[model samples]
Target chain A: MPIIAAQGLTMRFPRVTALDRLDVSVEAGVVGLVGANGAGKSTLIKILLGLLPPTEGRASVLGLDIAREGAAIRERVGFMPEYDCLPPDVSATEFVVHMARMCGLPPPAARERAADVLRHVGLYEERYRPIGGYSTGMKQKVKLAQALVHDPQLVFLDEPTNGLDPAGRDEMLALIRRIGSEFGISVLVTSHLLGELERVCDHVVIIDGGKLLRSQAVESFTAVSGVLTVEVQDGRDALGEHLHAQGVAVRPEGRVLVVDIAGERTYDLIRDGVADLGLHLVRLEQRRHHIEDVFTS
Target chain B: MSTSTIHDIGYRRYDGPRLGRGYLVRSLYVHNVRAVWGLGRPARAKVMPFLLAAVMVAPAFMDVGAVLLTDRAEVLMRYSAYAIYLQVVVSIFVASQAPVLASRELRFHVVPLYFSRPIAPLPFVLAKFAAMVTALLTMTAVPVVVLYVGGLIAKVPHPLTHLREFLLALVGCALFALVIGALGMAVAVLTPRRGFGVAAVIAVFLLSSAVVLLVQNIAEFRTNFSLAGNAGYFAPFNLVDIVQVRLLGAERTAEAVPDGFISGVLALLLCAALVGGAVAVLYRRFRKAGLS
Candidate 1:
């Protein structure tokens, strides 16, 4: 069964419709919801977290209705918001312990869990200091620690790499992947960077303008599209004309011949045709469809 | 040294008993109450609340000392009038700390963190309200207790009478705490910036009182005691004193006194209206802000 399923979920603001009829289903893995800034990624996460009610349609998480079981859903789901929400006056230990306690852990157990999560997030020796004194990387770790201290079944991390430097972004992505694979917790992480998601996410869901453009496994997203780009040291136009004469769809893209694989013997035909024309083959590689192709194609 | 083996302490799911929503609400209440006194905060954060508390109790202690030194029990202040007597300190406290309680979460955008948990928006608002009311209650009631004990130790006549007045003063303290806490929190929640929130709350208290006092002075010049007396309802401090005098049978001070029991009833109704109106406004405010 899917961990989360939305059916025609729509959320409308006064001046804008943040989410419009969004339909998605997510299984247990590190699923990346990829979108630009105003693409309703946060709105969908908020709806799934039961923080905002949709203007129309229904949504469910863990087989529970979002509208009716909002409290129950929140009880089992943890959320690391996109913006900075930590209280600056309190130490990380105090804040995480307080969050743990809010999640229904008793005082002693809350403190123990807080310490454990802080350590797990690689925050040591600095956990006792006030959060306001810490750097941005440290603050993001604190936010992640508080989200995990309660040991939720599923966690929604909104832009976990937001406001992080390159190194910090790498570390945060690694931590998110570990939470999904090692911890066996279902994660719904959102990011606009498709390259990073390709490295960490098992599945990617792309949304644009409050609509789901594509949702598939990460492997399928990067699979070869059967289009091969062939480059010759000499006579690139001659190669394209030869492939075209042989009833193959060929076009010249800059200094190379972009050949569509017409049949089962397309690769052999290309090699034979290049040799027959006495043209040296500089490069012949099959091109895979990029995740960015969803926008242009 | 033996090699340390890697322990696979992967994230463990919380299968232990999940407490109910009541626990979340109670935790918020405790957290906000501690925040009001600057507990678990920097030393500078602790200064204002503690200094105000000390300033509040010092007068009671000095009243006790003067009674002891001169052997005059009449110098001891009345317990029921403590809220009226220390109105400025209480106002300052409400102005400063209510922003700490009410606006800090909104200013820092931490309110969504709370609502995203197992708690509802109304409970979140209620918890803060309850915490502010409790903190204000402690501030007002503690000084009244000090005065009661001081008066008793100074050996004023009728100890039972003093106890009765002490109980009545506690009731007045509760009313003061509710009205002031509600008003301060309501004002503070309107503005997210702490400086603006603080200034707004102080203006609500001082400006409203000054306006009422000025109107009453004008009414007194015209010998209109009814109009001057009824003007007390516009001032929160005097309104509480009027309740104490009429409903609890405390002595009326030299300031505005109600014309009759009906006027006192009207003042009490207005107090109720103010508290209810503030709570209603706060409920809507938090509910809307939580969504946003």
Candidate 2:
């Protein structure tokens, strides 16, 4: 069953409509909610979490009605907000343990889980220091640790990779992947960076200006295109000319030659042409579509 | 020659019992109580509250010392009038700590994290209110208890009568805590910045008392004692003093308190109103902050 299902959800603010008739359903793996700024990604998460009431329509989380059973849904789900919400005065261990108790864990369980999750997030010795002294990367890890300390079946992580450097971003993405696969927890993560989500998400839901633009599996969004990319050590012009002479549509893009696959003959044509020119072949592979191509197309 | 391999312990799900809403409220209340006294915080945070508390309790020790030196029971300070004599210290304690309890979460954007849990706004606000009231009660009641113990140790006359008055004063301390705590929280929550919150709370307490005293003195100069008595309603400390003197039969501390049983009932009702109104305002404030 889908973990989250919404039907004709509409949210209207005074001067603007944040979400308009958004109907989307998400199954339990690592799902990504992709949207630009002001595209209502946070609004949709709030609605699902039952923190905000929709102007119209209905939704359910984990088969509980969001409008009526919000408290129950919240009891079972955890949320990590995008903004900086940690108090500067307390250590990470203290804050996460307090948050764990807020989720109704007993005292001993709260302390134990706080330690376990902090370790999992790669914060060992630094977890004892005050949160104010932490870097942006460390603070984000603390926020994530607090969310997971409650041991919820699913978690909503909003822009978890925000304000992270390249290495930190990669580590966070890898952590998110492990949360879904290794930890056996369903995750609904939101991000505006399409490429980053493409690397981690199994399904990507794209929204634009508070409306659903596209929702599908990442594989479908980036399926193999009918083009072959041929890269050689030298004589790129020679490869393009030879492929065109064999009645195959070919174009040179940067150092590589893009050839339109006509049939099985396309591969043989490129191999014979490269050998004839005595050029060293470096790469030969089928080109695949990217998530960015969905917008450009 | 080691043959044992390392075991990979992955994430473990919590299948244990998850307590209900009452546990969450209790945890929040305990946390806020600790915050008010700066417990579980840095050493610097503990200085203000402890210093003010020592200042609050010092006079009780001095009064007891005087009784022992003079060897006269009548020289002891009145038990019921303890909080009023130390009113400024109590006000400072409330002013400094109210911001820690009411506005710290709002200023740091932590309210949304709590609301996203299973708890609702009413329970959250009530827990905070209860914590503040508890802190204030402890602050005000400790000195009164000290004075009573010192009275016993000093061997003052009419010890049984002293016990009765001590019990009555304990009731007064509770009323003082409730009324002043509610007003301070109401004022502090309106200003999210801690410095502004502290200033605003102190301003409310000082300005209201000053204005009420000015009005009462002017009315007394004109021989309008009734009007002077009614003016006590404007200040939180005097407002509860009226309830104490008229209803609880304690000695009057303020310049004038409204006369008769009806006036006492009205004062109690106003105290109740202040508490209820503060809770309502806090609920709205936190709910809005959560959404933001």
Against the true structure, what is each candidate's TM-score? 0.91, 0.97
Q: What DockQ does each candidate score versus the true complex, computed on alpha carbons?
A: 0.48, 0.57
- For residues A70-183, write the lDDT of model 2, one tens digit per residue: 999998888999999999999999999999999999999999999989888888888888899999999999999988999988999999999999989998999899899988
Question: lDDT tens digits, residues A1-297, model 1?
Answer: 888998888889899988888888888899999999999988888888888889999999988899999988888888898888888888999999999988888888888889878877778888898989999999999999988888888899988998999999998888888888877888888988888888889999998889889989999988998899999987998878887888889899999889888777788889989999998888998898778888777
**Worst lDDT window (10 residues) for model 1 chain A?**
A288-297
Which parts of model 2 have CA positions greater than 4 angstroms off?
A: B1-7
DockQ of 1: 0.48
**Each predicted model: what fraction of the native A–B Cα contacts (within 8 Å) does it retain?**
0.67, 0.73
> Per-residue alpha-carbon lDDT of model 2 for B1-292, expressed as tens digits?
1111101446888998899988999999999999988888888889999999999989988888888888888877887788888888888999999989889888888998998899999999999999999988988899889888888988988889999999999999999999999999999999888888998888888888889999999999999999999999999989999999899999899889988988999999999999999999899999999888
Which residue pairs of candidate 1 clash?
none
Give the alpha carbon lDDT tens digit for every residue of B144-228 in model 1.
Answer: 8988888877888889998998999899899999989989999998877988888898898888778888988898999998888
